[model samples]
Target chain A: MLLGKVKGKIISTRKHEKLVGYKLLIVEPYYGHKKDTFIAADKLGAGIGELVLVARDYAVKSGLDKDAPIDALVVGIVDREPEKK
Target chain B: MLLGKVKGKIISTRKHEKLVGYKLLIVEPYYGHKKDTFIAADKLGAGIGELVLVARDYAVKSGLDKDAPIDALVVGIVDREPEKK
Candidate 1:
């Protein structure tokens, strides 16, 4: 899992078929890492700027559709901010 | 799929049983991205410093064991360097 913040969300009306009812969230890892922003499937209602844990592998689609093109998923919402190094 | 270059190899004798016969390579994406080095299973015999296309999602384990703990796989080797903008 990767620690990241939900930067924003993408509202798509015509995405892949398998991703119909899911919210696509844009997330980026916190400080001390590259600012690579990626889109993940949000199920736990992660909101903008909220700290979240993203699973960016097969585990994301394990319970859903094994072949879903969705590569990332928000697994948790962290309650506290990360301590600055 | 993401484009990356093989930086080095991990020689481990006591890794997960599912990753026994595979070569674990350290790969980093090319310029214009965060230098996040990650390990991926190499089945194509990619060499160090070679540009490769890594599948960092479920597609990687589609053909093999879907439950395999391997998260990334070198899907293809690029023939030339990426064009800089």
Candidate 2:
């Protein structure tokens, strides 16, 4: 998983059947001073600018059910700073 | 999948066993007027600011092998504009 900040939401008039009820957010992956922005499927009602944890690969499948059609998903919202380096 | 420009590469001193040889690129997902930036795994040697296609979920497994430890992987680089609306 990677740390990211939700930047904004994406609105699509048409989408895949499996993505109908999920929210799409543009997330900027934050690694210390580095930020790599990307979009992801959000089902946790994460707000803009909220620090979030993004799950990938097997983690994603485990976080959201194994059958979920999600490659990248917002798994958690960070409420406080983790141990600093 | 999403189109993006390869902004830069990420160098990690520590990584999972499967990700050791794969290149990681900070990508910005592009949607015409809307540009959603994010990072992704790039296996195609894509350059910075190059448009590319991202594969998610089952697509990722099909693009790569089934056991590849990638949920979001750069599958292809776009050389021309797709059909506009």
Candidate 3:
């Protein structure tokens, strides 16, 4: 799993059938030093600027379901602030 | 590659050396239906709520160079809005 922050949303008009109705959000992964940002899907009610945990690839597909066809998935939303100590 | 939005940050007191300076972001992939959010590393200067593209697994390692032990990495940030029509 990885850590990131919700940046924004993405709207797609043309896409695959497997990916309909899903909310797209831009995310920045929080490593120790700096923040790395990217795009991902939100299954939970995660809003922009919320700290969230994510799973990817096989982990993502498996987390959602075997037949979910998802490459990424938001597993959890961070409730408390991350400790830098 | 996949799509996601920046959600939040992750701070770990102890981590791998390769991941020391790398930024980790919470991301949700845009899978057409519902967003499948995940955590990924960002190499670009993407802010919160920015639509970005991600490369996972081998793609990530290769994109950032083999020496890097990154499982996920942001390759591109979406400049325009994704069409939902």
- DockQ for every prediction shown: 0.08, 0.08, 0.07
Candidates, ranked, lDDT: 1, 2, 3
> Which residues of candidate 2, in runs, are more than 4 Å off?
A32-35, A83-85, B1-54, B57-85
As a whole number from 0 to 100, the lDDT of residue B18 in candidate 3 is: 78
Among all candidates shown, the one with the greatest TM-score: 2
Candidate 2 lands at a TM-score of: 0.51
TM-score, predicted candidate 1 vs. hidden true structure: 0.50
Give the Cα lDDT of each candidate.
0.68, 0.65, 0.65
TM-score chain B for all models.
Answer: 0.86, 0.78, 0.83
Report the error of model 2 at residue A33, Å: 7.4
- Score residue A35 of candidate 2 by CA lDDT: 30
The pairs that clash in candidate 1 are none
lDDT of 2 by residue, A38-61 (tens): 557788899987999988655666
lDDT of 1 at B7: 86
The residue-by-residue lDDT of candidate 1 on A1-85, one tens digit each, is 8888876665544333455577766566776343365556777999887999887776776645445545677788999987977
Candidate that beats the other on TM-score, 2 or 3, i.e. the better one: 2
